[model samples]
Target: MPARDSIDRHIAYWRAEVPGLDPDVEGVVTRMQMLVRHLQRRRTEALGELGLLSWEYDILWQLRAAGPPYQVTPTALAIALDTHPATLTHRLDRLTRAGLVERARDRADRRSVVVVLTDQGHRAWESAIGSQADAEGLLLAPLSESERRTLVRLLRKVVLASEKDGTELMVVPRSVQRPEH
Candidate 1:
């Protein structure tokens, strides 16, 4: 038999409180939520060690991921990050002050502006991302390669179903394609 976890205890309490509760559904949802919370905490700690807040790392990461001469229009970045333009501007201001990014007039269109990633920004992004990857790897270390693959497949199915039932999933920007791993 598998070892019992906190989710198991949680489901037990809920089952007594509401007898109609489906243990299978409750268990799966609770476990996924708990896992996400755990991962978020780990990511927060990792980013903190690098002197980065989550949003700051996100902006730096998006800029670094834009291939060399790494830069992008503020509008495009706002769309990619799913943030409002005003909110993005505020973030940009903070990044700019930290010397992590700079706003430049686009040579192609004098009226347009672009956000360029500075060397310092790239280094910070790289270190933060490395820490994030290490944390994720440690989290999955208990699973075998095949198990990891299976888990991903199953999660993809769940995500697709959820998307189909409601709004479409946000499209990833073309410039932010996943690197070949």
Candidate 2:
């Protein structure tokens, strides 16, 4: 038998409390939720160490990931961050004041503006991302490389199924999609 974990105990308790509770379903759901919470906590701690709030790291990361000469329109950025334009404007104002980013008028379209990531912003993003990657690596360290690959494949399959169904949101955030080289 596989080694039992906290989810196993949780399933047992729920099965007793609710006679029809399905251990298989409950185990999978609870374990996934717990794993996400654990990762979020680790990421939050890592961001804190880099003196960044989660939203700040997210905006910086989105800009950094936008390929060289990292810049994007405020509207595009707002969409990428799944935030309102006004909210993005507020955040960008703060970022600009901190010298992490700058607002520049588009050369092609003088009326439009773009948000450019400064050297400081890139450095902050790099530090926070490195720390978060280390935390994720440590979390998955117990799995063999092949096991990790298998897990990725399985999770991708499940996620795709969810996306295909109407039950889950189908949009993949632009920041998360791999950029073409």
Candidate 3:
């Protein structure tokens, strides 16, 4: 059996102090939250070393996933990132100043603009992505290949079930879709 971690101790303390609590459920949820926080912090630190912020890395990644010519409308990018338009505009401003992204008039709709990744942006994004992958690997190093696969399957089950009512809002990016053999 796997050894108990901090969440195990936490659940024990909570269960003793509050008799009605379900330690199994509480431990799982708490551990999930703690794992997310840890991953986020690790990612932030990794990106920092490359002189990139999380949002910047995210935007570049989305554009990169969009494939060649690497551009998307500001509205589309904002939607994909789950961010407010004003907030995205601010990020775009910073990226533009950093020479990572450029805002250009959209050809199809002259009234609107498109965010395109510059060459420098691609280099920065690639660096950040490599760093992130290394960081994630380090985080998961304790898990064997089989364990990682099982964990991914289980997490997908939970996430998909949780998306029941919100399926319409989900965006299945092309990069994640399986290709034909």
Off by over 4 Å in 3: 108-111, 166-170, 173-181
lDDT to native, each model: 0.91, 0.86, 0.88
In terms of TM-score, which candidate is stronger, 2 or 3? 2
lDDT of 3: 0.88
The number of the candidate with the highest lDDT is 1
Inter-residue clash pairs, candidate 2:
none
Residue lDDT tens for model 1, 47-99: 99988999998888788878888999999999888899999999999999999
**TM-score of each prediction:** 0.89, 0.89, 0.85
Q: What value does the lDDT take at residue 57 in candidate 3?
A: 94
> Comparing 1 and 2 by lDDT, which wins?
1
Query: In terms of TM-score, how similar is model 3 to the real structure?
Result: 0.85
Candidate 2's displacement at residue 150, Å, is: 1.3
* Candidate 3 global Cα RMSD: 2.7
- Which tens-of-lDDT digit does each residue in 60-118 have in candidate 2? 87787777678888888888789999998899999899888999998879999988999
